[model samples]
Target chain A: MRRFHISRLIMLVAVVAACSKKPPPAPPPAPAPAPTVNQDSIDAARRAAEAAATRAREAAAAAAAAAAAEASRMEAARADARRKLDAAVYFDYDMDEIRADQAATLDAKVPVLNANADIRLRISGHTDERGSDEYNIALGQRRAAAVRRYLVARGVSEARMEVESFGEQRPAMQGMDESAWSRNRRAEFTLTAGGNPIRVP
Target chain B: MIAGSFTRGQPRGLDDGRAVAVRSYSAALTSFWLVCVLWGLRPSVLPAQDPVASGVRIGLTYDRSGKPGVALTPVVGANADSVRLILGRDLDFSDRLTVIAPDSGDAPVGGLNYVLYARMNAVAVVQAAVTPSGGLHVSVHDVAGKRVISVIDVPLPEPALSPDWRHAVHVVSDSIELAVLGQRGISSSRVMFVRGNEIWSVDADGEGLRVVPGTVDGLSPAWSAAGNMIAYNTLPGAGGPSKIVVRDVLTGRSWSTRAAATNMNPAFSPDGGQLVFAAGTDGFDLYSVAPFTSDEPKRLTARKGSLNSSPTFSPDGRKIAYTSGILGHPEVYIVDADGSNADLLTSSGFGDQLYRSNPSWSPDGRLVAFQSRINGKFQLFTISVRDKSARQLTSEGENEDPSWAADGRHLVFVSTRTGTKQLWVMDMESSRARQLTHGGKVQNPAWSPRLDFSRQY
Candidate 1:
């Protein structure tokens, strides 16, 4: 793992250097030659070694700063993702039709849509393991569409919502009973931005 | 145009229906013409005189005559059209069994040389009167075995439950395909992928496509070996830090674990109990998750000065293959499950032959499929696990993310050969190629387990 860390550190340094967009020119020619005794040359070599050690310390400091900056940027990205997860609207048992209450919940997510202009919403439809797989899929789709239609009608662009049904393959909870299933049969959300970062919540 | 040489029938009224059906078939020819025009030709069936192959091909007949049928009456015509198109596409995609269009006269009736007949009597209960079921059963004659295969009543889901009969057709076709091929069909399996920044599951043939919960803008979706759960790297911040999520697709519920910002390509162990992914604050290394309830993951790699990423598990779950640059350039390496005994699989240095990543083992555990760059473009390639001899599978365009089919005889990889990144399957034996989907640049096609072949109607 140390080797991995070192490689990453090197890559990080390279990335920072690349981003800075500056290249140092070749070093100036050494000062004009002067007669130097062996003792004087040894003293000059010792000073050069000390200076090299100082440069290493500075490089380490730069690396630590870069890492902290990266961490903060990642955290900010995560916060944006958490907001989408919080924006999801849930449904009551086994029904794909959105309840009147969901309208208010769905309306809450509009600001997120408005904020991320390129963001797209994936409305995943799911079902508890109660019904047949076929029935569950259709039901799941209906639920997803209900959520999608609501968002689109609320002025979220139609292009923003893509619906998918998991049928009974994925569930919020695993059990044969109803309580566990209530959480399973609902539509949830996924957000994608800039065609690169895709967040599932 | 097989209309020219029809033998005259006794009833002129029936003859008119035939003529009108034929002429209306011409005027009402619909998109079948367009399909014909599009392909200019469809692969014709093997010659009638061709000797029978190893498998049994069963014919299907649906009783379009009841209340259930009445409800389906309007969409019946459109549904049938789509079913035909889907069948054409599926048969073309698979190499195991061929789907033959219904011959003249009543389908599955006598005079059809097919060894087995399947009738779709009800959407909920498909009753086939084969001999193996004894009193009114659907009989399967395995000419090779010269005996009847097992026959039992199969209960189907209700018609109303099916999204049109197209799903039923694909499902039944898949069943017939399995029964005949003696191998599983991909019908029941689901393909998980990231689309429009979300993880989605569509039918194996790409029908009934829909996104899954918590999959929006997700990346690197990996299926558990048992094919139950999916793990992927979510865009930072649905929960915790940039994390890996394990989703129970059936329940629509999921949980997340922290990973580095660059963490991607999450792969599950064969048993589905644990996962290995890339992690690190600056340099990424392999990390293992187990005692899954624990919030902290055990770091698995400690190679101090190299970049390690894209960890994929071997089928036995005993070893992991990942890309590492500790040797001065990126190459594939294998390590033990507990993270010891690291072995370099590729000795390519900072040269053209080096720089390989994303190692995925074949289902049988013999070969590893991955992508390597040549002439500055990534292309799909396979390396024999035993000898490490590499063979490039694609050449014309940028091809990457190759996954072996369940049969292990074909591979599906994303390619930009057609001007868009589309999934294409390559038959290993014949080297023939066919595109699986159109529109939407698709990637990462993971073949599901061999289908449950016994679920025949």
Candidate 2:
């Protein structure tokens, strides 16, 4: 009986010693939810940085190509081709009707449009910095509508044409003169996907 | 005469109401006079004209600032002096209270010679004092009755009720104006207009000019009747097609129509309940939408093959006036709010029976103000609703986009008379037009209802 009692005391002392040592170092911390939000933001930031770098490279390449073209004599030819490829169909002052002369200009767009069916053509109308913007917008709409009607009359599908009116907002030139005013009153042909904006000023 | 001048981008023809620069060959000599003021040299203010001897006029008198014995507080005396100038200017601008130039002289001990002032057509007199506690104490006296009308003591704050003491004093001036004239004054209300790509606002006192947002191809900024919000159209870029964006002028909160393909020229209803704008997928037509929230707009006008735009609500909210290009050219048309009884307002009126657009109904609902294309110029004209008779308001320059103040006696319109297309305010009764803004082709000046300052932000 005395031997049993001593054994019990020894067991209690061992249990106390084990309990007093330390708690099992907290079940290795659960994967935090906080890092997930940070990860998404970090990924977005990295993508944005990568996109900025890509744009910088593209701009640099364009600058180099422009420099090379300037060194050569073919830059004018490139400009001329671009001008023809994206020609602007103009209208009379305060008039939206396509003049007899303007008809051929719009007709010339048919072949270019037919060649690239995938290219979306945006016909943006503008007006001289005159009158009220409300009236100008209406005039611009009529101008753009006349162009669209002409374009649709030709081989180009109406679905390919998207019309917008800047109504003296986007001016081709700036000044308080006839030269500036005339240039400002125009409808620009922008090839949204395939080509550059064809503007004549 | 220039060959190919009409080719490609140059749409050069005869000037058909699109002349940004004034073509007035006749030049007028601008005679300048050094204006002496009782206080601050308010540049925009013309020397206040003494009231005509026929009507009940009011004389404005101010407290002296540079008196030898009078001591001011820590605040500069200039601040106190500015308050007096603003009060006098506000009273004069109201036109209901025709005030002569203010003086520092107090009323004579014989009670300001009430009979003599009455004989001189002075029915009321106003006197203002700057208290030691940065307060403005204003007193209005009845000339004939020999009694005090009201004494207003505004305990001004360090920053004042608004951004300036001018706005704070305007509150008192308007109160006096209301008491004297029985008509509320819009002296403290703000006017918003489109300047270039951005929307800008200026207080009626010609102070506290600030730019509001939705600047990415913003156009046709219309002030809501609530006065705290401005609804404008933003041209499509990457955020999708043209959307009607409602911007709170005080708070930076914004609401927009979801993926609206064609929404332009947003005009709020008189109650600020429904928003009417020109929306077109196939062709233009007016549509009414819920304002300051996300809701689909119900089509208001559907004339099938015709184009309708620029819808403005009548002051009563019972009728709507809009510009409809139904007759091949835009003309002013009036219709019910539910889109019926479409009556023509402008057509075969005044000059050439040409284009008329941007119709703004007067607050009195008696006349509709619109811009008519007359003699190769878009001029402002008002048509009486009774007889459909059109009277020309402006003929000298390209004046367009007429908007009326709450008083229905003043108008703000776009003009190129002073070089660029700037906003000009004209007192319709007095025929006195003043340039409101100076630079950057400003257009579409929409005046708000008297602002509720408690809700301003």
Model 2: runs farther than 4 Å from truth? A1-81, A153-157, A175-182, A195-201, B1-78, B107-121, B155-157, B160-164, B213-216, B454-457
User: What TM-score does chain A reach in every model?
Assistant: 0.54, 0.55
DockQ in order: 0.01, 0.15
State each model's TM-score restricted to chain B: 0.70, 0.79
Compose the digit string of candidate 1's lDDT tens values, residues B1-457: 2111111221233211111121112333323533442453322321122124212332222222211100001002222333334443344345543322222222222232222222111111112321222222223333334344434334333342243333444444455445545564455555665555576655555455556665665666777776666787654444433467776645546777754333456788888877888754334578888524666778788975355666778888888888776765566788998899998876542236555666778877878887776776677777877887877778888777676666676777778899877777787766777655566756556655543422211
Task: Find the candidate with the highest TM-score and give its number.
Answer: 2
Task: Write the residue-wise lDDT of candidate 1 on A1-201 in tens digits.
Answer: 999999999999999988678554333245227645554455565667889999998999899899989877776765765665455556675455677866767776776566556777677777875433223444565677778777778788887776655556567886657787777877888765442442322
- The C-alpha local distance difference test score for the whole of candidate 2 amounts to 0.67
Error of 1 at A55 (Å): 60
Candidate 2 DockQ vs. native: 0.15
Where does the lowest 10-residue lDDT sum fall in candidate 2 chain B? B66-75
| Each prediction's whole-model lDDT (CA) | 0.56, 0.67
